[model samples]
Target: MTWLFNNPSEFAKEMISGFVSANASMVRQVSGGVVRNTASKPDTVAIVIGGGSGHYPAFAGLVGQGLAHGAAMGNLFASPSAQQICSVAKTVNQGAGVLLAFGNYAGDVLHFGLARERLISEGIPCELIAITDDISSASADEIHKRRGVAGDLVVFKTAAAAAEQGATLAEVLAVAQMANQRTRTIGVAFSGCTLPGADHPLFNVPQGRMEFGMGIHGEPGIRELAIPTADELAAMLVDKLLAELPAGISRAKGARAGAILNGLGSVKYEELFVVWHGVARRLQEHGITLVDSQVGEFVTSFDMAGLSLTLFWCNQQLEALWFAPAYSPAFKVGSVIKAPLLATEDIEAPAEESVAAATPESQAVAGQIVIMIERLAEAVIKNADELGRIDAIAGDGDHGIGMERGARAARDRAQRAFQQGAGAGTVLQHAADAWADQAGGTSGAIWGVILNTLGTAIGNQEKPTANAIAQAFSQASHGVMHFGKAKPGDKTLVDVLLPFSEELTLQIEQGHDLAAAWQLAARKAELCARATAQLVPKIGRARPLAARSLGSPDAGAVSLSLILNAVGETFPAVHPQGDTLCL
Candidate 1:
């Protein structure tokens, strides 16, 4: 369990600050994450890597001369926002191009893919490569669907080394992909990891049993068996990893491979070495030459008493790159001379033009919107635990905290925007950005899309009428479906949103009052949200354990319903065609 936290909300920020301070010689603080302190060769491709917090050394600790040029760190167990990724990529760009590398988790895939698009649009060439190296996560034929685990280190290292050699972005991307395809990892856990300030771990293993093929975010393992001796555990890991060889290598006979015995979190270095002894013996028996063996923590799930083994099947080219001289704050290869640290300078984002002036009537509507947002926040906070519990049934248990953070941030930003004489649309837009920036997850990204679409539909020029609100709801639903790529019945917020928006549009077309239409639509959303309890998750991390969520509603769906109902209660009594906006 975690301790010594000043504030649970500020833990990630404080952790980043302390990490940068401790490694001043290796990295400097950037807007989104940390960048290498040493200057790089101009026009060389910059390799930027990242994921959620709790996995140290795998990310920021690898930002140095011979590793990642920069890292985009996010909140614990959450992917970084697209804006955060963009900020770090821009800061690390060296005039030539940038390459984004990360694990193949859904949230990371969505956010990083979006950031790549944004960067490319801005004329800064960028590419993305998601590492899928955990063999246990999927079948050998479905390697692309595998989750990245300890093997992320090998892929990141290869790409960073290629970039350091001044390879073009395409070359670096090819190297990263090659490494990913050649690497395979398998992990087993003795227990689960507890998040900071949480009462219990996200999931737990039975006493005297070990969980096999577990995730780094405290996700339960695929199977469980009675705990074995250290040597037996090591043999199990080695056997599982070696069972599926890379495409080029049919067998491991007379082949060279790089190996890593990684401690998930709480496992001691001494214990890792004990396991490695058995792993090394097995490799030798199998006629596989161990080129470079690493035994310690590389990628980790916080305080999880578990370990993973990664095998990188190396061809001639991969072997050379794998053994190449490299230097980083965490991992290092052969001799590396100390490089001069670059002077620290604040890199501020370009300032936005001021918000447009709002009519007095629109400004009043904006004030009402702020109150509605506050109510949303209050409802979220009140039901945060239940949301988290529902999510924990089949997903990471951070949904409640993430929603709380986004709701509070949205409310705060809406208040500020309203005070600045902004209209309803402008206020919602600001809140949307703030929610995505602070929440930093798939749900956050979807919320940003919903609010931004609604804001755009209800522009600042006029008071929003029932017809306009219905159109905005329709647009919001379409935007979310397009952005999240989640269809109705995916057991996501989209499930609730689609029916609500459709009913809202129908009600408005039937000449209902604004308040009545909204209330009716909200009821539809509530029913849809409750119906999610009978549906299985078809996306995100929960997909693997879809059956486990059979009786629990999607956390996003529940929160959406709660917020919509709260907003409906705040609607004013007014006619659909009245001069005053009813909601």
Candidate 2:
């Protein structure tokens, strides 16, 4: 659904046409998948780049002054044929020779290898530099065999600079190889990407979850789990990459490394920054210093909501070449400096704190009330469209999608608990797990925690009274505060929850019946939710878009009021003797 192309074949040709038209001055289209540009200087070694079409600014955009002399392109997510590579080599090869710099994929290896042989037969000297930077794509024993990622840029830049300086083909290849060896990359995807003209995505990631170490072509990943906060995600990626580095590189090289926070596509600049901030902080904690950092949509997959992190350990020579001036449609060197200082050992030590843990009481009641909760969760899921429409008034329309996805997951968990003959506590815990796993945004997790907390507070409590309801509400509020970090007046669900809790407590203390207290609480919640229209949001996704949200009640708060009112409507006022009480 994301792609607008008529077909994959047409998409490939259209992109090539646009590329050639725009880069006409810098490059000339050759037969097959190749494009050649004049080198900055005659007699300088030439660099040849090649890759599939999806990863833009890679094999194609890098062709220009002080970069690849030509590029061999391929169809979407498919490698260029050997003939394509050979054609590129023949067109670009001069007396000085050419160096093939490309990522390490099976298709690339097969075709580029064949091209090398063909070039040799034609009496044209050609060398190769295979970049293997994706540390997460393979095991430790296979690290050198992993696929390349954004770090390919470092290899291309370094090799091109060396070639531009008149290095021989072998020298250029060696420089590129060194850069490839020193570089490492790892990526995570919040969702899978659809290929051009494909209705379905290459793979499907469950809503509210992410896959760690996913391939560009939607290959299976290391694991899939609930989407973590930007900080948590950054830490996970940096930790994996750091673990794969030479054991003492940090101490030996003073931990100098360049970082590329690349958006896979559809990931906003703000989200990228949030991830980068965490990455930067984590790198510092590991005594790794960031020399230079770039954040943008350098390489994309047609609106895939994912990101890749690349790190290159640099020595003096490689560092010099990295900073060397170069011009290309996609890349430019603006400033150069010596590597930054790494933090001291004491400062870089890992924090000892743990992520907050769920309580024991919630685990107890989950088993007995599984069916009731499952039904409630199903109702929420069914109303997802309506919820989304309400949220669209002042927020991103994803709220409905997020809530529906989360509720279904929770309902499934409740059903599973019932089937497994689990207790009420287990059911609550399972529901929380399902909600977090299915609903990816901040609100889903908060609501899940709230439900779990409420279940815990009322564990096995039968014939619930006003006091019991107040206690459950209080606990739920705590869970929301603990997870969301929003206080009263923050224009979050807490804005509604706090007022409801206060009213419930007051009514119960005044000896009001259970249903009467709930009705009072529901009224207070509605008033509080409506009042949020006048207050500015101070938390979550709404905070940044607060200007647009002015005069609109907080969507979560409004939903909370509605749900509470629905519950009150279902169970009206009842006296202690269980007789219907008049309004």
Misplaced by over 4 Å in model 2 are: 34-39, 247-253, 334-583
lDDT of 1: 0.85
In terms of TM-score, which candidate is strongest? Answer: 1
lDDT per model vs. reference: 0.85, 0.71
In the range 162-183, model 2's lDDT, one tens digit per residue, is 8877888888888987888788
TM-scores of all candidate predictions against the true structure: 0.93, 0.56
Please give the TM-score that candidate 2 achieves against the real structure.
Answer: 0.56
Candidate 1, run of 10 with poorest lDDT: 574-583
lDDT score for residue 123 of model 2: 81
Task: Please give the TM-score that candidate 1 achieves against the real structure.
Answer: 0.93
